[model samples]
Target: MAVAPLLVFMGAAFGLPAIAIATGAFTTSADAPGGVRWTLSNLTTSVHGAYLTALWGSVRLSALSALLATVLGVPLAQAVVTSGSRALRDAVMSASGVLANFGGVPLAFAFVATLGNAGVLTTRLHLAARGWSLYSFWGLVVVYLYFLLPLMVLTIAPALEGLRAGWREAARNNGATSWQFWRHVALPVLAPSLLGGYVLLFGSAFAAYATAAAMVGSSVPLLTSQIADALSGNVLVGQGNVALALSVDMVVVAGAVMAVYVPLQRRSARWLA
Candidate 1:
């Protein structure tokens, strides 16, 4: 009884929508004579040409953004965990919590204000003359890093905290230098957590929509934007089924990311245990 309401909410909010999308992806159009016929045409259409390009673009963007986040986040997380100042640590964690959830259209506008063609820094630095454009792929990368970095920090902070200080002491007592200690002890223990964090960031970037949509419109090929276009019939009429097919594909990719993440998370838990 305690969890019944939550179960009902999940069924309505997620279960029903997922079922609808899956069914619609395989169902023939209503105009067809038969009541409902299953077809693979929608999935077939979703895998070719522009759709294919969008999918690949999304994969590349997610991988790059996540990789950048991991590279920067690990050090930042370690710093926060090892800092002696409680106030500083609290401030950073609080900011991270807020920033991690700050995305969509507002984040896009914020970037525009800072890096757009007529933006303060852009104009001041003459970035346009230097051929820098905020609507480009690298520009998106910079914007994505804003949220991705914070998310990575929050995800890895707990793992960093789990690092027992005694291990470092033991390493030092054993004549291990700082570099040797990290390479031999720290890195190995943190490996699973780092990989898991990367996977989480990858999925977050993969499913993102509004920020990219607002920043570059459809000029940037991405799966989420393509789904929006298909559903809105912006490019071709009656592409809703195709959009559903793309959603299915996105779900599959997310599932695969988790499939890898779960194992790493379990392994990391063993170390902490």
Candidate 2:
């Protein structure tokens, strides 16, 4: 009873949309005899040819960006944890929380203004002559990292903070160098947290749409952009259902990631708590 409003909100927001998507994904359009017939054609089309290419492109980009973020973010989390300044830690955490939620066309526009071909930094730093292009694949990865790295810092910081100081002391007393300590004791204990953080970042990158769409247009061939194109009639008419099928595919992939992430997150929580 206490959570009725939350439940109602979820139903109206996610539940309704999910039902519509599922219905659209597996049925013929409204013009079908007796109003819509069951079919696998939409789902099948979603996984072939150009759609397949877009799906793979999204997977490659998300995986690469998330992996890079995890590698770099663990150190950032560790630094904040060990900084020994509560004010500094709080400031960084606050900033991270905001950045993690920042995306969409605004983020894309900001990057373009700062890193695009005619951007001020591009001209001043001669990045264009150096083979830099903000609308390219690697450029998108860099933009994604702007938010992903911060999210990684947030997700792993609590685990880092929970690290017992005595472990470091014990390692030191046993002559374990900093590198050896992390390679062995620290990393082994933090493995679940690290993996969970990586999965979280992967999902964020996977479902991202507006930023990719605005930044590179169809030049990148991401699944999200393809879905938008289908739904907006930018492609063949009646492809809206194909867009729905693509969304279903995205949901399945996200569901699989969450299936792995939830357990790792729970394990990390138990250890950290």
User: What tens digits encode model 1's per-residue C-alpha lDDT throughout 1-273?
Assistant: 999999999999999999999999999777656856899988998999999999999999999999999999999988988888899899999999999999999999999999999999999999999999999889999999999999999999988988899999999999999999999999999999999999999999999999999999889899999999998989997788899999999999999999999999999988976
Once fitted onto the true fold, the runs of candidate 2 whose alpha carbons sit more than 4 angstroms away are 32-35
In TM-score terms, candidate 2 sits at 0.96
**Predicted model with the maximum lDDT:** 1
Off by over 4 Å in 1: 32-35
lDDT of each: 0.94, 0.94
TM values, all candidates: 0.97, 0.96
Instruction: Compose the digit string of candidate 2's lDDT tens values, residues 150-176.
Output: 999999999998888899999999999
Report the C-alpha displacement of residue 272, candidate 2, in angstroms.
Answer: 2.1
